[model samples]
Target: MFWKKFNLNKQYNILYLDYNATTPIDPRVLDAMLPFLKENFANPSSTHYFGSNINESVKTARIQVANLIGADETEIIFTSGSTEAINIAIKGVAENYINKGKHIITVSTEHKAVLDTCKYLETKGYEITYLPVQKNGLINLNELNKSLRSDTILVSVMYVNNETGVIQPIKEISALTHEIGALFMADATQAVGKIEIDVDDFGIDILCLSGHKMYAPKGIGALYVKKGIRLPAYTHGGGHENGLRSGTLNVPSIVALGKACEIAEQEMQQDAERIVSLRNELENELLKIPETFVNGSIENRIYNVSNICFKGCDANVMIGRMKNVAVSNGSACTSAVIEPSHVLAAMGLSDDYAFASLRFSLGKFNTKEEIKSVVEILKTELEFMNS
Candidate 1:
């Protein structure tokens, strides 16, 4: 166990395996944020001493977030969430680089944030190429290369698929995008704190990440724009975040996000080892049920996630049976829609199989005992289904 002794709130007593959807804020992160909420309540933009002190905290947050992704502090732009970050990265790039090209490339299995933003751009006369994924939920580099055009100004691919957890070949894709002088952007919401991510190492021109996906509060995220790359301002106001995003910073959440990043940097390796062990045990035991199989490229996925398909089992019904556990059929962002998962469909799953899938994303707080209990509950539920 990564945590020697941790106490979960009463409301969080049930097993939570939905880390990809959103993580529970770490107690330490909460502690770091409380001071900002209570005492340091001044606006960071004000010239007063209270504001200056808060502003300093925000700068510290910028450095912490930048350090996690190997970016410079000046390159980081604070946004409301990854959705806003995606909008800024895609739309800003489109606006600034439109003179060079009016085309964008992205994968079909991306989060709705990227896909919907691309669709919106299509209304503005920008051409978009939605690349297909293989049955293993992996993109074909050859197909991607073939899709690139001189007019392609950007290629937006996600570092990890929200449902399948399959990681993309970012380095290779970055090289391909750069060959045509286009910018490479990735939605790293699922990969950032879970895996070791260095934007410099990956040669990514723009990257988006959500604090809530790690152990931080929601409504806080950052976009890493490469030093030389210029993105047109998304919000037009006092020109905060290096004139890219404009607004008074959410000091409490910003502090929480920074503290969360610092902790993630320190405990990532240990967390991965322990979480992977629990996930493997859960997967192994869950697969014992008849007609069960894991989805996506298992070898190429993040350690904390396992998307499993229970053949002939309705995921909604399965979750209804396991009342004490928290899981999801797909991205929580799309939970309101009662249709089959778009991510699974892109991987060539039939509507039936897609609806039958469940995403089990573990986290640092999960323990061996919790894994065992969940596995037993699943076995019981499967038996009941057969009966």
Candidate 2:
């Protein structure tokens, strides 16, 4: 009923199930953003009256974002997106803490932003240990414990896997990293709005999230750096975001992200209840199809995602044929790459099964009717493909 007030035009009669890739901006978020985009526009860093007022709005937004994740408002640093935040967190630590160590530990299944950033660090003589995951898509704690070393500066892990929705053992990982005197970071882009997160409770020294992943507009995100942690400046301009990230603040999108975070804090429990039920119904029915299996640890995943391996079905072809049904085979970032998902491959899936997998990610806007329609469409498409 709440979603009914929002006009989801369902462009081209499509049923969208790709929330992990990005979410449609909530009408409430847009409403909060419009004022900044038009008459209220002012440089938050300026001393002028209008700019002073706009700066207050940005401060409120910072509090809103921090409140959602149980962080102090001062801990939040605005960035362009998760990629930028990840880069700042990883690269900044490497730069500032180079005297202490040059080694970092991250998982093999991390998003390209983290993986590629670590790869780049390798050229600078940093030692990166990419921990492998089990078939259920969870990192082994023992392996992580053994991997921790005196030279390890940071341990970066994602809170949830974008494709399979696999929730990682962040608290345990953080504990292990701390034992070796290393800071812990989490890319919570896919986890922040979808689940509860407390930076202090989880021992997260640094965390990053993208607004677009949580029903806010694109080009806005935040990095949470714990108190007493100092990261090197990411940009060199009029010092913004506590001199960590610089340049003009994106006031409109920041307001939108704040509103989205507020809304998510209020509605996450109910949203999870409804969406998980729909996800279970869809997953159960789809699993009835022959040779289908779920990917990742079903018991340890987020409520909205179901990555299913449909043996013998080419996921790319299946997606292409479903003209009005929007889903994905893997991360949208790597969609252009011809290779199968490195995540699935790291979890020991053969190329065939990896290519056969499809990710169905539900969102608050999706309805039971839409789920049924999607299931029917997939069944029909699979039958035709088999024939």
Candidate 3:
């Protein structure tokens, strides 16, 4: 009924299961954004009355984001998206803590935003230790402990593997990072709205999340910096976002992200419950195919995703065949690369298995009928491929 109020005519034409790639904007979030785009378009930095009112709205949006993650309003820094937020957090730490240490630790399976940023830092004289994950797509705690050194300035890990839906032990990882007096940062782009995250409880020094991954429009995201942690200015301008990221605020998208966060806080549990059931139904049915198996730790994965490897089948070809269905082989960010997923490679999957994998990520908007249709489509496609 909630979705009925919106025009979902185009969405119904495809069986979209790629929530991790991005999500459709919620109508409620869109409604909250429209006024900001039109009548309330004044710049938040302007000194006029209209600008002051718009500033108040931005303040409210900041509070909404903070509340969702159990952080203070002052800790939130709006950015273009997770990539920008990640660049600020990782590079900022590298720059500010250069005198303290030149070493950093992150998983081999981190998103390219984190990996590529760390690589850039390496060119600047920082030593990066990329810890490998287990076959189950989980990092070894002992290895992580051994990797930590006195000169390690930061340990950055993603809260969830976007491809496999595998969740890391954030609390445990943060505890270990703190033991060695290093900061912990989690790229929570894929986990924020799907799971409950208390940055303080997890001992996170820095965290980044993207709005587009959680039913808000693209080009909006926020970074959480724990109080008392200071990072150098990421952008030079009017000292906006606590002088970290300076630019004209994206008012409409910010409002949309705020509304999405508010709605997520209120409805996440129920949405997860329904989505997990549909995900299970889809996965269980798909596993009936020959040589098919899940790619990650079933016990440790998020409820909405099922990354399965269909042996002897090429994922790209299968995806091409399923014209009416939308699934993915891996993160959309790396889709342009002509290779198997690095995440799967780090998990010790063979190239064949990695290329054979498909990620079905369900969301609140997906339905049982859609799941069944997707399952049937995949079944027929696989049968034809095998034939």
Candidate 4:
């Protein structure tokens, strides 16, 4: 396999362009987290030296998550990952405010985290409106306006599309949701480390983010809820996370996440400038090939992602032949589905176009040379496609 080198242990060198999927943990984050795993491990709720030390780390991590997204420290609650964070955000709101309104709104292009959560809520009798997107893969705001009713309690959208790297018009969408008196929730999973976010300016009531996508270890994330926004507790026990999410915190992972968030704040713009240029270089080169078209709004996308749909080759076959590249056919979540990308389908793309899609997400460690090499590898593989 092309990724065998990355799969194997030491000394292997393969370029990675899948940052929107997940990022490598920064060395600085690991250093800041060493003590928690080695010596200072504590159950943050306890009252002792071990606990006191962890208390500081947990508090610091909360502040770090808040700083990255421009939210208040008290508003951030620790979770297992963005999936759980999203679950808490959506389900929490659905159950808490169901009495006021049972209608919830979200776009069809949302990650499975939001969709599956809403699907579960649907079983509970909540009305969900899956808004359609344009051929370019953007949600229709006019349709959103029409969907909002007096009984609409929440509207959830993603700040960034994970597959295509398209950025949603969050500020405008937030304003629309507010006008209808519905609370707005955004899954900022793809935007947390790669883009800048100011919760107050964006006017989002709740947001979800993952640490692993921004260089923190997996199994640790946070959910941000604006002050005064009440959500019912889906996770019940021992009254942790201010009675919102009750669970023991992952100290080492939390510390790592906090440090990762700090790095994201300090380096996000520079990283974006570099990654965007590299992604463009790769995409521009792909344009030289006869059959490839960059998916979504190329000009209005996150710096770290590019979804390319090649004309003649199937992604399954092309994906296997790109021995010099590490990319995905669609999303990691739906890889097992073996079907055309749902994101592409929602954009009104034909099955051929959808099945031919590939996602190449760049990251901080990516370089110009790597971009050129990946493009060459793709070209070579495209030539090898029989059809």
Candidate 5:
């Protein structure tokens, strides 16, 4: 949609609802990053004193990231993104510090980062239990408890369902996980900046987040591993990111992320009220069409996300008709294929409904007028499709 303002001649102005996939960088965030990219270019790992000055920006970002999750700065380790942070969280913990225990537990509805990582670990002789999702894409606490055994080393669950906007019962899960002395890991990529979180109060041992998700630049994110936890390192280089992830620290993106976090900390409450209201208005208007239903009936779903399933219209057809609405099929990372989203299938949706699901994600810039017009367009298109 950002591209549309420049090309105003295009008919049917576009709307973006794919915030679950990614969000546009807030202008303030971009402004904060400008100096690091252009003038203050410096490697945070450099030995020279001048370039090393960039570490201040990186440290500030670290505090910002820490603030969002209620984590300590020492607990945060910078990485390329959520995918990399997830890899470090799981593999680093599993491989470097292998115990006699080889059992791990993760939900079937987990992001590809968790599921795919578990699958790869399977080849390495580790046993994993893929927990099933309820019809609403939430895992059963009893089932999770039943799966945990004496040999369980880790339990990874996402804090929020990316496709359905379902928020998991993290406190309950974390409490149960720690009771058995197993580590609890959370892929907080979808929850951070949009919801409230606290690392210590929630009993989280490991957590992953993406800077891009919070209005910062992509190619940078952070992993939080609680202090006193001896997880193994994934990256081996000149020792960056506490030697957990080895790379020259991304100074520019790091600075941007810190600034984004600062803004998120200050504006989270207001943003939640506004974004949630916008999404609700959107759902109310669009649901006026016959045979369209919300997939997950979560009362406490993320404020910016609304997953709607139009019974007959194909996702591709809907997308074609919707125009510049930068929304998604289910998940943006997995939209490259013709597959009916695995997430919807896991949530027990039939192919017809799953294929019809569209994710509209809101951001700091989305307006109510834009949402209203989007619904009007959908109403017209649905009528045409039915005709």
Candidate 6:
């Protein structure tokens, strides 16, 4: 009976504040991608009329993705997602630049993708220096400077910490990396589309991003390789994606990603202003609860994320008690593990504080009313926990 009057297409009941995990695909993106999936179902590599048209669509998508990050069209390489991109960037650099150096530099707060890749390299005898972060989740530049060695081949840092939303000083780090002749690579999955990214301006030699994080369909991502940077192919076969990657292109998803990037470039500023206001309101209200603390650098954080530690409260219990709200203690990638957040732990947070943290990330579709309701839900759940 309720569904008789309610339009399911536009209606939502869950107070979703987990945009960091992934965003719901935009309708516009779906609209743009449908043709590729249905009528234009042809291989881009095929020597036929359908293939020719599809190839043009793929090229257009590539340019759209490239333009979002201020990269040349030739520099974009589509991948399954950021994880794959990270693997390509890290392993490619390690393999190609091994002659130049067997050392890589990264921050302790980097996503597991970068850390695990470096760890794998460690098995091959490559040295990895994981620079620690200060209590505010900011890496120590001086420590970084000291860690750079003549043999350092790559320095991988994320543009934003997925859990804490703390933005790294990418430009400065890029400068430092170049000074040592090491390539600078960034996992920008959490930063791209949420913020303005100019790969050239940031001096980032390689950048990776996921379309799912920015209102596109999942399983679509792209890596930006600055021109002239040589990375060994991530996959071997048909030599697609300029021979850097080889696969039959997922044309529908690629088209969706391109459309999402186009929308992001056009609406980022407006979306940021609105989302930040809602995020601030929710955060301020939630922090009013006694013993609650904000995690990481408040000033340097991105507009849409607020990671808060509810002292003496169990994050899992609180989440379970809060009805109609969707939030997380940390990254979805690490949610299966019942462990404290590595990002918070890397910033010197105690085990209890790390376990008590919850990440609230807002998105374009969320409303101020939703933020208020989430705050109220949190308040009720926290009070119950305290009692």
RMSD of 3: 1.2
Best by lDDT: 2
The lDDT per prediction is: 0.90, 0.94, 0.93, 0.85, 0.84, 0.89
Write down the TM-score of every candidate: 0.97, 0.98, 0.98, 0.95, 0.95, 0.97
| Model 6: residue 119 alpha-carbon error in angstroms | 0.7
Give the least accurate 10-residue stretch of model 6, judged by summed lDDT.
1-10
Q: Write the per-residue lDDT of candidate 5 for residues 1-387, one digit (tens) a residue.
A: 332242211333556667778777887788898988787886776769866788877888899889989999999998889999999889877875476488999988888889999999999999999998888788899999999998888999999888888888899999999889899999999998888899999999999999888888889888999998887668688777777777677888888888988988988888888888998999888787778898875674787888999988887887876666677887778777778888788889999898888888887667777777678777787788889
- In candidate 1, which residue pairs get closer than 3 Å at backbone N, Cα or C atoms, i.e. clash? none
Number of clashing pairs per prediction, in order: 0, 0, 0, 1, 6, 0
After TM-score superposition, what is the CA distance of residue 257 in candidate 5 from its true location, in Å? 0.7
Off by over 4 Å in 4: 1-11
Candidate 4: worst 10 consecutive residues by lDDT? 1-10
lDDT of 6 by residue, 7-100 (tens): 2123777878998999888888989999987888999999899899999999999999999999999999999999999999899999998889
Candidate order by decreasing lDDT:
2, 3, 1, 6, 4, 5
Candidate 2 lDDT by residue in tens digits, 84-119:
999999999999999899999999999999999999
Worst 10 residues of 2 by lDDT: 4-13
Quote model 4's TM-score.
0.95
For all predictions, the C-alpha RMSD in Å is 1.3, 1.0, 1.2, 3.3, 2.7, 3.0
Candidate 1 weakest ten by summed lDDT: 1-10
**Which lDDT tens digits does candidate 3 get at residues 1-387?**
564343232556888899899999998898899999789999999989999999999999999999999999999999999999999999999999988899999999999999999999999999999999999999999999999999999999999999999999999999999999999999999999989999999999999999999999999999999989989999999899999998899999999999999999999998988989999999999999879999999999999999999999999999888887889997778898869999999999999999999999988888787888888888988889999
lDDT of 4 by residue, 1-387 (tens): 112223211234676777777777777788899998887877888998879878987898889889988898999998888899888888888888978889999999999889999999999999999999988788878999999999999999999999998888999999999997899998989988777899999999899889889888989988899999898876799889989877787889988989999888988887778777888888888888876788898767887777888886788877676665678877887788898887888998899888888899887777677887788777777776753
> Clash pairs of candidate 4?
17-361
Give the poorly placed runs of model 3, Cα more than 4 Å off.
Answer: 1-12
Clashing pairs in 5: 14-324, 15-324, 15-325, 15-326, 16-326, 17-361
On lDDT, the stronger of 3 and 5 is 3
